[model samples]
Target chain A: MRVVYDGTFEGFLTIVYELYYQKLKPTVIEKSALSYSLFDEVDTLVTDETKALKVLQGLQKWWSRKNLQTILNTFMCDSKSFEMDLLKFIRLGFKDEKELQNINHTSVFAIRNLEKEFFRHYHRMTGFVRFQELEDETLYAKIEGKFNTLYYLGEHFSKRFNNQKFIIHDIERGLAFVHNQESKGIHQVADFDEPIYSSKEEKFLKLWKTFFKSVAIESRTNPKLQQSFVPLIYRTYMSEFG
Target chain B: MKKDIYTKMQILSDSAKYDVSCSSSGSDNNYKTGELGATENSGICHTFTADGRCVSLLKVLLTNYCIYDCAYCMNRVGNDIPRAAFSPKELADITINFYKRNYIEGLFLSSGIIYSEDHTMELILKTLRLLRHEHKFNGYIHVKLIPGSDAKLIDEVVKLASRVSSNIELPSNKSLKLLAPNKTKEKVLQPLKLARDISLERTDKVIGMSTQLIVGATPESDRDILQLSSALYDKALLKRVYYSAYIPVNNHKNLPALVNKPPLLREHRLYQADWLLRFYGFNWSEIVNEANPNLDEELDPKTFWALNNLHLFPIEINQASKEELIRIPGIGVRGAYKIIAARRFKRLGFDDLKKLRVSLKRARYFITCRGKYQNEVALYPEKIRYALLEPAKPKQPTLFDINYSATTGEL
Candidate 1:
């Protein structure tokens, strides 16, 4: 019997229990769009709230709550071979609690990969995020990142600029959060239209461009090194470079 | 005009190439209004060059015009070289433009003495001040302290720069007198002492200081170099002491006739010995003696120290403390921590050591794991010396270098 899920963690956990309790053989569980076989019988599994909670509660005894959340998030990201790896990890979790702590195991590969990707994005944003001053006397930034790391990045930027009102626009994902003077809040915007620049801002940017041109040592001008830090693709959006 | 610029650049860059400490780290400054950009304490590694050097900062000299004539320096007054000077505005603009394109972490500005020591120091300080105040650039800046600059100028420079260093070109006073008559030991050490004192006083700021010593310039022994470096570290609280191997550039009557190249391997050995002093807690007397001033070029400094002190060997890895682990060859601070953490979970055997990627070739002679190992090496005093010193066959070249023609497929 083949089972189809709604591509959610709860639905997948319910399918795991159905396979175990019903003692079914030749079972395959897949997301909705992944179903292509003509001969197999497909039963679409609905997300059962109570059964999913029971399975998660049982998993908490073997793995820490944080580790379970990491595994679930990694699965929701739609990684390759995630279902098979999750199944193996769940099996190992039943066998020995110590197996959950081993990071090098194939079962925990998705969690480890997600952590690496998170740190990479965090470091890149640390260097690449540029803020521009708008005509309304507010600071603004735009980033087009692959991961949904805006909340974590917002917390970092909040700590960096506590007294300023700024907005970070996710150009690729079409989401932005406006942090006002008093508190920080998230908002979704359709797209960014270029804000009007004031005369003072234009003058300051001109002065900045002049200073940038002056500070580079002609003796040590290496474009190859420059390309490594801010790649050519990012140059089009950068004010000084443009 | 462009050819002249290129020529001056080549001369100045070649002159400034020897000083190795170019790290722009451990500071936090944000771009304010009118400034080009800002800096972060978490330093950026801009790029690695063809020579495997990390090009982090725009390391350059303000001018290639010197008053003093150091025999080993290409920019010495007697050498025939083109010279160039950038106005403070020019320097500030270049830094801003390069920073905007993300070419470098920041600026590491040095200079050949233009006129008087005070005049040169003031010019460099003005450039940095303009970059900070006028340009609003809060970036990593490392400035070189001219040997005879006024104490007040050094103080002002330190406030604007992230890190400061003074080059003590030769280790001893005798070598400084013979090669560079204008520079004395006291002149070089005085400004460094003032910078160190000020940095200590302003502990809240991100202050880092370092020094550089030219190796193989004169006949000063490696023992003298290590002793001086150790004193600088202990007394001056220096972050690093760079060793630059002397490259002959000027022809002078007082210098030795050209015979052999500068001993790069010897310089490398001194760097290792310096690292041992700084990180491994090994004293100079333990590593070197009065008679033998040079380190063994074939083996590393830590191995040499371990070979000399055989009585302290065969330490139990799991049971030994962190201090004892640091003394063993091939075991760094990180390796010791790994051993400590791994042993908490399971009893570490030879297999576990292999898994941790510890260098078994050198470390096997020094450590015992579960009180046993496979091979039985020499334990006797005389036999162990021969075993450590025996020449081994060279291994094949790495895959990165091998089959160059086939990989490139050049017709």
Candidate 2:
């Protein structure tokens, strides 16, 4: 069976419970609109607060509260092989509370790998994510990330520039958040079509690019290492490379 | 002078690139009223390159003109190569410009011997002093102490700089004579000892000293290197010891012909072993013996250590003390702490370890729950070694696996 969730963690947990009750082996559990499977029987699951809370309690019984939170973070972030590995972890969690502790050992190495990946991306974003000052004097940023890390990113940006008014847009996911000098909140927005950059913005980018190129040692150029650190995909948005 | 500066900077910096301990950590002090910039003690990490080398500082050389012809050094004076030297002012200007743009954290300046030991030392000291006093640059400066430099000069450089280092080049004095006749064991050791003593005396703003040794250069075994490192750590009070795998840059009658790449893997193993010695409560003798100078090419130092000490396996996860927990193959210092913190609230078993995300495959052989895996069939050391060393084949991804999106945007 294939299950389509509401792109929400609670909705996925509801599917987990449904699979357990029905004793059905799910071939795929994906977010709504993302599933393209035709052969498998698909069930669209709605978010159930009660059922989600029960699952969270069951997970807490076996694993410590902190570990359970990490697993939940993995699930919400939509980690690779999360569904299969999480199901196996849940099964083990029930057999022995110790089984949940051993989640690091399971064949599904996705969770730990995902944690490193997320932290690495987060670290890169700290340095690489650039904000441009608009004609209106408000800062704007456009990012193209594979994961829905907008919430976490907002927390970082808000703290980094406390007094500045800024808007960060996730172009791929079509989600964005705005933080003004007075208030801090996260809200979903439809597609944004902003005007082209002013001449001053273009000049600053050119200067930044020049500065970047000038600083690197030509003799010590290691393109392989540079590519490994900042992948070609991220180069699309980086002011120096783009 | 400008051309001299550029050529020398390129040669010396390129030569110094292989030395992996260029960290600019400790004490944060910025320029008050000078030309430009300041230093933050947290040590800014500008970027990590493909080879995983951190580019925090402007790692370069003051001159590539050397008096000693070390076989492993590309800039050896006898080698038929172009030479260059940077005046103190030229170097200071480049550092200031780079610092202002936030391209580097600080300057990591090393040099080849120019004119004499004292002369080369004076030039380096002059550049640093200008950067600090005249330029009022407060960034973390890691100056390389020239062996045979005057004690007073070394003391002055240490006071003006955040960190000072001198390369031992080779492990033993015998190897030093064979490869670099100009430099002896005392020549390298004296400067390092002087830096250590001065740093100890002035602990307020003084950062500690570090040293590097070339691996796979001579016949000295890994045991010899480790013993030397252990002594340096215990006696010299050195902050760090870096190992650079010998790359054959110069060919001479005295040097070995190019056969294989300077055992980069072996160099990496030594670093792992070094970490264990410093943090994991391991000793030099415990890691390698006289007969086995090198570590296993395949397994990490910790895994090798665990396999060698099999009798201590299957220590109860909940019961193992902090010291015993550190000995586990998969558990690091952080992992051990997590285990301790988690177990305090609940009785931890095999499943709990998985949830905690410890590398259980390596740890399983070394740990037990309720004395269960104590009498399990132990695999032959060769088989275990093969299993540990052999790289696993990449598994073909299933349709479901392919469809699954990675959380952090990485493939």
Which candidate number maximizes TM-score? 1
**Model 1 agreement with the true structure over B110-185: per-residue lDDT tens digits:** 9999988999999999999898888667778999999888889999998888888888888888888888889898
lDDT of each: 0.71, 0.70
The sequence of per-residue lDDT tens digits that candidate 2 reaches over residues B14-88 is: 666666676877655444431344554455565555344566777777877788777777778778776666778
Error of 2 at B193 (Å): 1.6
Deviation of model 2 at A106, angstroms: 14
lDDT by residue for model 2 (A1-242), tens: 77677867777677667767767577766666574557768777778988887776777666677667666667645536477666665666566655444424543345555665776666565445656767665667778765566777677556434445678777777777788857767667675678455445654455444434434533344566576777776666666565
Error of 1 at B186 (Å): 0.9
Candidate number achieving the greatest DockQ relative to the actual structure: 1
For candidate 2, the C-alpha RMSD (Å) to the true structure equals: 8.6
What TM-score does candidate 2 reach? 0.68
